[model samples]
Structures are given as C-alpha cells and as structure tokens.
Target: MFIGAVPKEVVGQVLATVPFDAWGNVYVGCSGSFRFDRAVKMRHPECRVYSNDVSLLTCSIGALAMGREFPVKFKGALAFVEPAIDGLDFRGRVAAVMVAAAMGNFTGKNEYAQVHFRHYREHFRTFVDQALPKLDALVAEIKIEEFYAGDFLEQADRAENSGGGMACFAPTYKGGYERIYKLVNENVEWPAPKYGIWNPDSLPALIVSLEERHIPYCVISDQLLADRTPTTEWRGSNKPVYTYSSNQAASLRRRLPNEVPFKYTPVEPAAITAESKVSMCVVDSKRMTYLKNVYLTKGIEHTTGQINCLVLIDGALAGGFIFAQTRFGDKTRELYMLSDFAIARERRLSKLIPMIATCREVIQPINRRLLIKVEYIVTTAFTTKPVSMKYRGIFELDKRTADHLQYQSAVRNQSIQDVFHEWLRKYAGQGGKPDRQGQAARAEAAGEECALHDAAGV
Candidate 1:
C-alpha cells in the first residue's frame, strides 16, 4: 500500500546535486524501502551511511539487508521454512522471514494467516525460491553502518549535532503510515508512531521546522512544488519528483526543469433543496492534510489523540474538523477540544454543521460507544481581532487571551439529522436557492479570469 522505494532515476538525480563529499556521514530518515540507502551506500563506500525508520519491520529488513546483526528470533512460517532457505546466518534467516512476512502482509495474508493456512505455504516457498536470492545479493552489496528505529526528527537532530553529517528525508506522502503499514505493524507488534507524516500539503511546514532548527537536510517528494526554496526537479517513474535542499548553493547548481504550478479546482456547489443534506464521518490523514493546506492557515498539526472528521454538504466534502482529547488536567468528565476547523471558500455552508459536529449530544454518544465519556466541548481561534467571525454565532465566547480567543458551546438536544432537515426547510421557505441567470450575468461581467476563483480549494 505504501512503497518507499525510490526509482533509480530519482536516485541519480539526488546523487548529482547533493554535496556528499563535504559530509563524512549521511543519515537517511524515513527509510521506507531503503532503496535510497542502498544507492547512497553503493555510491559513497567511504562515507558512513545510516538508515532510520519509524517502523520496526522496516528497520528489521533494513538491518539485515545492510548486514547488521538482528537480535530477535522470529517464530512462525519463517521458522518452518528452515528447510527451504539454507546457508543463511542469523541475520539472513531473520531477514528472509521478515521480508516474507512483509510481502504476505502487503497482499491480504499476514503472518498469522500464512502460519495458520496450509495454502499460504506456497507463497512462502515462492519467496524463498524467487525473492531470497535477491535479498542475499543486496546484503552482499549494501553495507549500512547502522540502522535506527525511532522518530525522524530525533534522528535529524542527532545528524545536525554530529557537525559533519547530512540528512535525506522522504517523509511519507498524503496517505499516512498508520493505514499503509497496518498489517505489517500489527504482525510485528509495533506501537503506533507518535510523529506526524508529511505530504505535499504539509511539506512547507516541515521545511520551515528543519530550517528554524538549523538542521541540514534534503527532501524527496513526488508532488511538492517548493516555493522560493532551492529545488531540483526530475521525471519520476509515474509522477514528477522534486528534491528540496537546505543548501541553496548546491541546489542552484542543478538545472531547473520545465514545471507547472499546482492548482485546485473546487467542485461546483449544489443547489440547496429539501434533498440537500449535511453529514459527518471519519476523515483520513491524507484528505485532512489537503483540506488543511487549502483552507487553514497553519496547515496540519502533529498532535496526539486527535480524530479527523469530514464535514459533508449534500455529499460533497465541504470542510473538516479535527477533535482532540483535552490536554489539560480535567478529571471531572472527558472534554473534547477542537484542535482545528476549516470550511471550503467556494461553498457558503452554514457554520451550524461544525457547531453540531462539536456538540456533546452529537459526538458524545458516538465516542461513548467507544468507551469515552465526553461532557464539554472547547475550541480556540487564533486571530488579532476581538472576535472570530467563524465562531461568532455557533460558539459562545468564553474567554479571550492575549494571543487567541477561547470559546465554549452547549450541546443541542435534537439530533443533527433532524436539525439539518429543519434548517433546509427554513432555507427553502426563505428562497435560499440562487438565480442561475443572475450568476451567469455576474460571471460575464467579471470575465474569464474571474472564473479561476473557484480553483483555490484543492
């Protein structure tokens, strides 16, 4: 589902621009497939190449491929394949097992399933026959100095402090690692990562974080169009790959490619009717990141204990709300804090959708079913003005701070569906539907360039 494997073309592009001769050590953070690590080791044999990833399974495979001694013994299908895979030492044997497990997990069958089902033995035998030889060859070629399993930020900090080291980060894009590596993670008993994954939408923040902390780094992403930053673009296997560097001099040395700026096209707004609806559902990290980048000023925040929800207006993605458990000491009852709220610029949806979304009556029971008892809902809006227009009608301003305005709202008694229907009825009675002829006349008066206004929300 998630492949960190960098193509040879991109690797060549990276090796050409990065000033590896200046640094004694190179750190590869978020080493998903370790393809870049292998390439770096192959090119710079004299340099100490280290690989670090958040997943234990990824580290295990990386360690074995790079010839590091793995301490853990695997018990299951791999153990049963001792007869098939021969002449492999402890590291090779473990590597073979882990690689096989990862492959099986990628396909619907996990280690447990492969171990239990007799039909799955052929898959293991197939890997032993076809894939193990490649792994053995890679082990012979790659010699990674060390492999680390932890947060990439911590690893990057160490690289910066080391004085003569550089970090290359290919942070996971759009889709987060949680769902992509779910099967392999569960099989390895790896705990959920505490760090945030970066996508094109959240990459600018990541670059700023690295720069502000004075960390020397380069990033490889597929969709990032770096703004005013030193970047080199290359044609990837499927999409264009852009490498962003902290070293402006080195980046400027590379020739720039013919590139096009990214644009977002908003979906046409549907007319409000009795059938027009509002709903909320769980939103994935990928979708949430895109929405945040388009609508919210701060983009995505790397906070723990947060649930992302999608706000739908007539089945279209109108907005999003990120709710987190209160970080403060509140032993009284479970409190839900609204971490971030955003709405589409094109769709003029009511703020009531988000209001009901955060209400205790609406979300409380849903969380209660999962064993969380929520009583109060709280939110903060950061703005220089005395009041935030977004929260004026929906949330009651409870307190105002020097930097932000805090708001609290009471839960409504009616269900969200019932309230939505009533609101629609009232809207229809008020002739809320727009006049198409007037809209067309305004568009003609504004001209073709004005039609591009809807392209802001992507």
Candidate 2:
C-alpha cells in the first residue's frame, strides 16, 4: 500500500470533475507514490504525464518502474539493508529502498536499522511475498513519459507555459518528509531539497498567482482554506478534500458535459413537488434518533440533549432538525442554537423546508415548552463550499469561525396556529395535501401533541 495516497474513490471523482481529456500535457507535483500520474495516464492515454518530486527514493522508484537506471551511488553505506534485496540491478535496488523506507523511523532523529530492528526485519520478510507483485503490476501499466527530481514549482511553471496543459499538486501538509528519507539520503548523498514541506499558509498567495497567470491547476489540501473558498469539495473521504482550481480551469470545467459532479446522488421522493404541503411538528427525540450522528463529519452527537423537531413534506416525513440554548453567547439573552439539521436520503427536498419550519413553525412551541422568550436564534453550518446555500438568503451571517459558519436571526412574533394558517393560505389551491395540515393544527390546539407524529414510514 502507498503511504499518504489519495483514496481511489476521491481520485475517480476528481477525474470526473477535471477536464483532463482536453489537455495534452499533465504535470503532477510532489508525486510521492505517483498515484495521480497513474490515474491520468489510465484515463487518457494520449496525454503525456510528468511526475516530479524532491525525494530521491520517489525518483529512484519511478526510474525503476520505467526500466531506467538508478542514478544515485550507495557507496556501500546501505550495509544495513537485507541481502535478499539483490543490490545488483535497478529493480532489486528499488525494492530495497522501498522496503527500508517503509521500515524507517521518521519520527526520531536517527533511522539506522538498529533503531528499528523489528520493523526492518518484518518489512524485509514481506517485501518479496507481498509488496513486489504490486510494484510489478504498477510498473506494467504505468506509462509516465518523464520523471524529474527537482523543485515542484519548476514543473508547475513548465505546465503553465505549455499553453494546453494541467497541473496537480498534492503537497505534504505537515513537515518531516526530509527526516523520513534521511537514511536513504545519508547513503546516496542526494542534494538538499530546494523547497521544504508546503506551508498551508502560503496557499492563498499561490492560488492568486496561478489565477493571475491563467494556469489550469488543482491543489489537494487537508484543511479547508476559508480565505478563498474552494471551487469544489469532494466528500468521498471521511474528512472533506478541498480542491482549488484556477479561473481557466473553472471556466473549462463548467463547459464540460457533467454539470453536477458531486458525490451525493439525488433520489427524489415520489409525488413531491413545489406545491407539496409542508409542516413542522414537535416529535419525540427518538423519532429523530436515526439522524442523530450523521449531520456532520464528526457525527450527530453534537445535537444530543437538545430539542428535536421533524418536517413533513406532502404528508411524508422528509427530515428532522435539532436545537438548544445557544452554546456560545449568554444564556440570559434568550438565544437558541440550531445544532443539527438533515434531510432523508430518499427525499430530494429543498433545504428551505427545514429552515422555514424551524423559523416560523417551531419557534412558539419551543418558547412555550421551555418557558422563555427566544428573542434571537442562531445556527452554525460546516462546509468547504464558497457559500452555505442553505442560510444564504434567510439568515444574517453573524461571523465565521475556523470550523463553521455562524448565522443568527430574530424569532418571529407570530403564534404557532397563526403561522400554520399563514402557511395553508400561502399554498392555497396548489393541489396541496390538506388532510395532515388539519391534523397538525388540531394537535397544536390540544397542547399535548404539537406535531403530527405519523411514524409510519419515517
């Protein structure tokens, strides 16, 4: 297995989004395992793929993968390497370095075999039986036209000047690659890296430079750079992978066939339309239990011990929302926080359904149940998207923290029954479902059941 490799599903989605088919030349910077290079070559055989990196081990492996010679001289400094590695040929030497590098201890100052004897032994034992075959297969299919050992920016400049080319950069987010390859460097005496680990702080300037130059490019980053929002985000991985593209690339991508290339596929609920009747009813927290740990990447646990409500669209359980006393500001201020919100997988409903329900319908019931007047309501959303489309028009953007977007709005002064009647009048003569509407109004009038709890198909 390759270290720090992008997930295969993410690679597929990136390929699906990027307009690589139209470009003749593609350059991959910081090509640690050459994963992107291999993917681009596999998809478009006509494109010439170039791989560049500062690590000698990476370049050595690339050379061996292409049946070329290993340029570095070991000078017998690698006596710690196992004898089974067969140091006589390019392929065997490649195997030797790959195994040793995997076994080396990068966290510490020294990486001698004695320091990590057990790891070195284990990797040596499994190199031929497990790792070699994978490498052999990779070499057979990979047809990268050239491999360069130099600064990544030099290669990026080449791609930028090529007139019809694209560049992909997957830089090391954290420092210490130099330490990881210290053992190999000590033996081969490769030159010092002209560039160190990529500083995420430098991303904004680099993005601006690439855009000003009109270079077609993509950058893979660990954290969402909120200064300039990414053109698109792929959620195939556990943590969102943010991809920033140049203006030229963004324009070209928009012209491609697939307009929506996100991972979430739409499966619209049956017989639901813009005219469908919508209602917000109080429900047992257990009714919204299924969505408890799924609203965000961290899970739905954040909304636990908070108030819960469900939204019905066209008399069908569309989704649910949760809120509680504001976790940030003073409790005496009478502010509530909309902690979590989600839609059912089967229903491709508008997000406005939940927003409007939370604001207009649930406010009075929640205020009455809690015995307080909620003068202001706040909500937070986490996304790498340029705009949180759900709250763009309805709520005022209060502030943006590092992790999420915060929005607040004043609670409307209307009664629960008044809001319900207003909704019914708004959707009048739209072939709306009036059956559940009357039931919801009756439940609210009784004060015991403020919401329609038809848990039939939730």
Off by over 4 Å in 1: 65-89, 96-120, 174-176, 189-200, 250-458
The clash numbers for all candidates, in the given order, read 0, 2
Score each candidate by Cα lDDT: 0.54, 0.55
* Model 1: how far residue 358 lies from native, Å: 36
Residue range 89-182, candidate 1, lDDT tens digits: 6555555555545555435457665454454455555655565566666566656777777656456555655644545555545545556555
TM-score of 2: 0.49
| lDDT at position 139, candidate 1 | 61
> Any idea how many clashes model 1 has?
0
My TM-score estimates for the predictions, one after another, are: 0.47, 0.49
Model 1: what TM-score?
0.47
